[model samples]
Target: MFEWMAWTTPVVVFFTCIVLMLIAMTVWEIRSPTVMRKGLLPIATTRGDRLFIGLLTAAYINLLFVALGEKMMAWFGLEQEPSVWISFALSMLLLSIIMKKG
Candidate 1:
């Protein structure tokens, strides 16, 4: 409905921007990378580096939500349920594990 969309427009725009920026960063990394030298070896040319970048991006997003989450929920007329908090916490833990592996 028009009314529904009118309210969701801003949220959609914000998310879309975030997605686009992430895609751009990823493409840039793939195209060009800055190298770091350690001792007598170069250690920046690794797939793990890309994985780490993605994980860091994901963590930044999650932290952004967790930091301003309460306000966003209230703005959207969403209730702060305990189960939701628990799920968010679990998700963060899972993300941490993925980062650790990376």
Candidate 2:
């Protein structure tokens, strides 16, 4: 059914996962309310707030790695494909830290 859409499989999966996470969070909040807490981010945040910040951070991290990684790779004559994996790893680490500490 998604074949006609212009989005790649990864894009579709990413968005689908986001939608599912939002739904899950909504249900979780309905069941048990979240309390605001201060974290390393310097601002008090609830679950949703942290999630929003984490997603935005992950997107920016990926963009930066892709944009700068290409230039750096070209400068050093290195392969470009590994940058994606590196960015993904870094983003995942950041996301986990945010979820745990933020």
Candidate 3:
């Protein structure tokens, strides 16, 4: 069904994961509803709100890494490109903290 878009494997997998997460969230909500809560962020947020914030935060983190990775590598005298795993890990950590506290 996704063939027409001609997306690469990673792109396809990323979107598939996102779709699956949304489905899972929907099911969980139907089973047990979530309440809005205020966290480090200024406003109250629900599970869906937290998910959106996490995704946006992850995207920005990845973009910032991509934009500055080269400069950072050069400054540190690194020979290879920076690994994206760092950004992924940081994103997950931020998501966890937000979900737990916010």
* lDDT score at residue 86, model 1, on the 0-100 scale: 52
Q: Which residue pairs collide, candidate 1?
A: none
- Cα TM-score of candidate 3: 0.88
> In model 3, what lDDT does residue 97 have?
80
TM-score of each: 0.35, 0.80, 0.88
Residue range 1-102, candidate 2, lDDT tens digits: 856778887988988998999999999999999999999888999988999898889989989988787677778888654458889889989987997799
Return the top candidate by lDDT.
3
- Each model's lDDT comes to 0.57, 0.87, 0.88
Model 1 spans with C-alpha error above 4 angstroms: 1-46, 81-102
lDDT of 1 by residue, 1-102 (tens): 567556576688867977886687578668985444232113433434544554566667666667776787778777772334554566557545543443
The numbered model that scores best in TM-score is: 3
| Pairwise lDDT winner, candidates 2 and 3 | 3
lDDT: worst 10-residue window of model 1:
37-46
By summed lDDT, the worst window of 10 consecutive residues in model 3 runs over 93-102
